[model samples]
Target: MESTPKHQQLLHLLLLTTLIYLSSAISIQSSFPQEALPTKSGYLTINSTSGSSIFYTFYEAQNPRTPIYDTPIVIWLQGGPGCSSMLGNFYELGPFRVSFSLRHNVEHLTLVRNSGSWNRIFGVLFIDNPIGTGFSIAGSPDEVPRNQHDVAKHLFIAVREFIGLEKSFENRPIYATGESYAGKYVPAFGYYTLKKNARLAKSRRLNLAGVGIGNGLTDPEIQVGTHALNAYYSGLINGKQKMELEKLQEEAIRLTRNGNWSEATSARLRVLGTLSNMTGLATLYDFRRLKPYEDDLVGKFLSSVEIKRALKAKESISFEVCSDLVGNALNDDVMKSVRYMVEFLVKNTKVLLYQGQCDLRDGVVSAEVWMKKMKWEGIGKFLEAERNVWSVNDELAGYVQKWENLTHVVVMNAGHLVPTDQAVNSQAMIEDWVLEKGLFATGQVTQKPSHIGTCSIG
Candidate 1:
C-alpha cells in the first residue's frame, strides 16, 4: 500500500496505454480481412503423427465463388525443405496478392477481377508445414517428417480429416502443386498418396486426383544434369570446370547405364552443386544468378520481408545434406531415407511436369530427359501438339507430351516458381489441363499481355 514512485506510475500508465492501442489495432486489423473478402475464410487444425497440430487457413468459396469448389482443390506445397506453402500462396498463386513491402498491407486479387488467380475454378490451400512453419506447430521433432514419405502421409491424413470435418470438399479433385525442391517432395508425396489410395481403396477415404509439379525435382540425375548443362551453356562454367563436368557426366551416365546408380548419383550430387553455382542443403535448386529484387516482379514478390520473416521464424527439419535424400535413388548414389516415386508414375497417377525457361536450377533439361525415359505404355506422341493455347514457335512452349492424361509445359521467360513468375500462363495451363482440354487445343487460349503495367519483368 506504499505510494507508487512517480516514474513507476508513469511506466505503468504507458504500458496500459500501449496495451489498449495494440488491442484495438489487432481488432481493427482482424476485421479488415473478413470485411475485405467477398467470401469468409475460417480455420482448421489437424494432428500430425507426432501429435503436433497443423493449422490451415480455409477460405470457403461464397455463393458467387461456389463454382470453385466444384472445380478442383489445389493443395500447394512450396519447396524450401524449410519453405512454407504461404510462399506460393501470396507470392505465387494465393487469393491475396501481397504488397511490395514484406511488412505492409496486402493487395487482394479476386478471381473475378484478375481472371488469372486459380481461385477462378479451384479451391486453393496454402499450408504451413512441418508444424513449425508459420503459425502451425508440432508436438515434437519426431512428429515432423525428416523424409518425403512421412511428410506425404501426415499431410494427406490431415487433409483427409479437414475434408471430413468440412464435408464440403469430399469429392473435389485434389492436386499437389509446388516448386523448387518440391521437385523431390511433390513426387514422393504423390507416390505415397497413390500407394496408400490403392491400399485403402475399398474404404473409400482417399480422394487424390492428380499431381502438378511445376519445375519440380522429381529425378536426381536429371536435376544434376540439367544444372550442369545449363551452367555450361549459360557460361557459369569455365575450362577446368567444364571439362570436369563433361567427364563427370560421362562417368555418371556410364555408371547409371551400367547399373551402378549409387556411385553415379554420389558423383553427380557432389559435382552439380559447385558446377551449378549452388551451395548449402537446398541450394541445388535455387537460382544462384538472380538476386531477389533484380530478377522480376515474381522475384520481388518472393523477396518481400513479410514472407521472409514468416519463413525465417519457422523450424526447418529437412535432411538435405545430399541430393539422394531428395531425388530418385535408382539413378543416383546419394543415400536419403526417402523413397523414390518413379513407381508411383508407373502406377498411372496423373503426373504433370512443367518447366520455366529461366529456371536455371531444375530446368527443362531434366524434365525432358526424365520424360523421355519414362516408358509410359500410354498412347501419345512425346511432342505431339501445341497443348498450351499460349504457345510460341509452334512448340506450345508447353505441351501434352508423355502420358495421355499426363501433360507438361515450359512457360516462356518464367523461372522456377512458374505460378508466381508466370501466373497467367500457369493458371491458363492448369485450367486447360484440369478440364481435360489442351492448353491450346481450342486454338483460342488467351494471349499474354504485351504490357503488364508497372509490374517488373518476370
Candidate 2:
C-alpha cells in the first residue's frame, strides 16, 4: 500500500528514537583478564544538584533464577573509614580477584576468577564512597564529606545517577551494603533514602529494599566496650591485660559521652593495639591470617597503566586502599552512633548484620553487645530468637538468628573477611535471603526457639 510522505517521515523518526533508547539501556562491557561477569566501570557525576563524582563498577547477576530485573540490586562498600570499594572489587566479593605475586627485582599482580563471587545471584555494584577515595576525586578538600551524614547524602545522589544511567534498574529491589566502617554508612544512607522516598511522589522515588552490614563498626560507645571481651575470650589477652583493656574502653565511653569523637576512636584503637602487641597477633581485622594486611597489592594493581587503559578508567587521581585525607576529614564523626538511623529502617524494612565469628574487631561480640541496646521495635524479638544452623551444599556453613525485621548471621571459621574465607557459604546465604523474600525469617518459624544451635554448625 502507498503511504503518505508525512507518515513515512514520522515512521523514520520513530525508528531512530527507538534505536537511541536501546543503545542507552545497555552500557559497554569491557573485556577483562578473568572473563566472568558482564561488567562495566564508570563514574556517576554525583548529580548536578550535588556536584561530586563517585567511581563504580557494576556487574549484572550471573546465572540468576529470575531475570536480572527481578534479582536484587546489591551495592557493596568496603570500610576503612576511607577504603576503596575496589578493595572489595578485587580482593573480597567481586568476580575478579587480584592474583598477587612477588618476584626478584619486581613484584606484579594479576586477575583471577573468583568462583564464589556474589555476582552469581545478585547484581553487584562496587562504589568508591564518600568521595576522594580510590578513583573518585573532588576538585578541592571542601568538596569531601566531613561527617557520616554528609557521606550518606553524597552516596544517595550517586546511586540515583547510577539507576538513571541504566533504565533497566529503575524498579529493582535496592540494597545498600558495606563492611567495617560502612556500619555507619549503610544505616545512615538507608534511612535517608527511605525517608526521601516517602516524601517524594511515587514516580520520583528510588526503591530502597533493605541493607546488609558485614563486621561493621556502627556504635562507637558500645562497640569499643567489646574489645576487652573479644580479646580475653580469643586468648589474645590475659586477665591482667583484659582488666586494663576494660579500663581503656571505659575511658573511650566517657570521652564519647562528653562528645569527644576523635579521641574516642583513638582510645578504642589503643586498647586493641595493646592486645595485638602482647599477643603477637598480626592484625585485629583477622586473627586467622599469620601475616599483616597487605593493601599494597590492590594499590599496585589499580595503579598499573595497563589496567587503567584496558578498563578505560578515566580518573586522573591516584588509587589508594585507604585515603588518609578522607579519614582525617571524618574523624569528628567516628564516635557518632548510627543506631537511630538503623532503628528507623528496622521499623519499616529489613536489616541484615552478618559477622565473622572469630573476628576480634567488628565481629559477633561487638554486634551483639550494641544490638541489645538499640531502641528498634525488633530488639526484643531479635534477642529472643534462637540460633539455627545454615547449610550450603548440604554442609553446615553458618548460624542465623532473626527477629521481627533484623537478621544476624555468624559465619564460623571465618575471620573479618567472610567472603574471602567462606565465599561459597556467604554467597549462598545472600541468595537464599534475597530470594526467600522474607523481612525476617526467624529460626523459630523453621525450628523451635533455643539459645543456640542444637548441633555444632560450620
In model 2, state the lDDT of residue 157. 85
Q: Residue 209 of candidate 1: its Cα lDDT?
A: 72
In model 1, state the lDDT of residue 224: 54
- By TM-score, how accurate is candidate 2? 0.87
RMSD of each: 10.2, 17.1
lDDT of 2 at 407: 85
Q: Tell me the whole-model lDDT of each prediction, alpha carbons only.
A: 0.55, 0.79
lDDT per residue (tens digit) for residues 36-139 in model 1? 24232222344634446554544443222345446577777766554556556556676655443222333332212333566656676666654545445556
Off by over 4 Å in 2: 1-38, 47-51, 102-106, 437-444, 448-458
On TM-score, the leading prediction is 2
Estimate the TM-score of every prediction.
0.67, 0.87
